[model samples]
Target: MASEELEYAGFWIRVWASVIDTLLLGIVVYPLLTAIYGDAYWEGANFVHGPLDFLISWVLPAVAVVAFWMARQATPGKMAIAARIVDANTGNNPSTGQLLIRYLGYFVSCIPLGLGIFWVAFDSRKQGWHDKMAGTVVVRKKSGTTRPVEFNA
Candidate 1:
């Protein structure tokens, strides 16, 4: 088996990818919610209720679980960026239980005002707190071919 090493994704690329993913998710979800609840959903006293926060607290974790699980298992976003997530211990895709644990760890990372995301920017291994907790790493996918280089003398 090939050795799977963790690839440090540059901070900017990761930020951009996350922005794209969030926008895509919002584009799909917002319209679906609007359609289901109708324009009146945002009217009246109920509009100012705490349901949005309630929904978020519950839904966001679930979404993160599904997204990370799929990404780790199938390399979804990582595949798009020529990367992969693998278990640090085994150098293979993480198990479902590991993925769930990883997702749960996100809450911890977010506790101190999202220091986990910052950890990626400065950590020696570029592993976020969640990554460390889950024992997983993201690595660039290996390209089979090398490019020719020309040098000026």
Candidate 2:
């Protein structure tokens, strides 16, 4: 399909979706972390305080987010805003490998003062580095429409 025919999610919508996802994650993560580490949880930068911390902070979130992407095409926050993640070249669900790469690509996107994320604001397709790495795009239902529009490479 022509690019103009698709309604790609822009930076602001993506930002809002991220905010929502972060807040929701906090709702669950904060209490659990606090319960495990007490007041010292926020006081340190240590990544692995214990097995529980490792499980809660690292493993759980990675599994949960990837699972959501694989099963639902979008996270809860993205879904709330009617956005879906798709393979940019095919406008279909991404493969498991692609999704995993996308998740890891987030680290790359964030490492350089978020330049990769900011690229979305300038790119015509609004793809961040992670999106580019995974060959994915975020799209939303077009105005007054029930389905998201398709796009191509």
Candidate 3:
């Protein structure tokens, strides 16, 4: 059991985490993309411009996110807010397979007018569809304390 009190991170905090992550990623990725493909990259008709775009626009973020999850159990944004991802049932770190599924599940959560993501607001466990799909949850110690979340409790 967790030695201290924990809270399910609510919608607003998660949104802020996502915002921070997106902005940070954009800061790094957009310039590189423009440098590699030129400003026309934005107005290009193709979803991806070329090989460099595929590597930059697609592969880089995937690798970075999974790497972060493996190393920290959270992205920089989640880390900023002292949140972590864990197995929904175990309250322990999720396996690599689960983390990958969780990443892919973001597409599913965002597909249906983002109803899946918004589901977090109503779910008793405070899970988005991605979380439910991957059997994972985002959790944190409430306030400034370090009461790590323990799911088995």
Best by lDDT: 3
Can you tell me which runs of candidate 1 are displaced by over 4 Å? 4-6, 39-68, 71-76, 142-153
Give the Cα lDDT of each candidate: 0.61, 0.85, 0.86
Candidate 1 residue lDDT tens string, 1-153: 354322455455556666665666567556655766666655745533356534643676377546766665533444467655667666667877767777788789889999986787886555688888988765554433322111121
Best by TM-score: 3
Clashes of each: 1, 0, 0
Which residue pairs clash within candidate 1?
7-139
Supply candidate 3's per-residue lDDT for 124. Answer: 72
How far off is residue 58 in model 3, in Å? 1.2
Candidate 2 collision pairs: none
Candidates in order, TM-scores: namely: 0.68, 0.88, 0.91
Number of clashes found in candidate 3: 0
Better of 1 and 2 by TM-score: 2
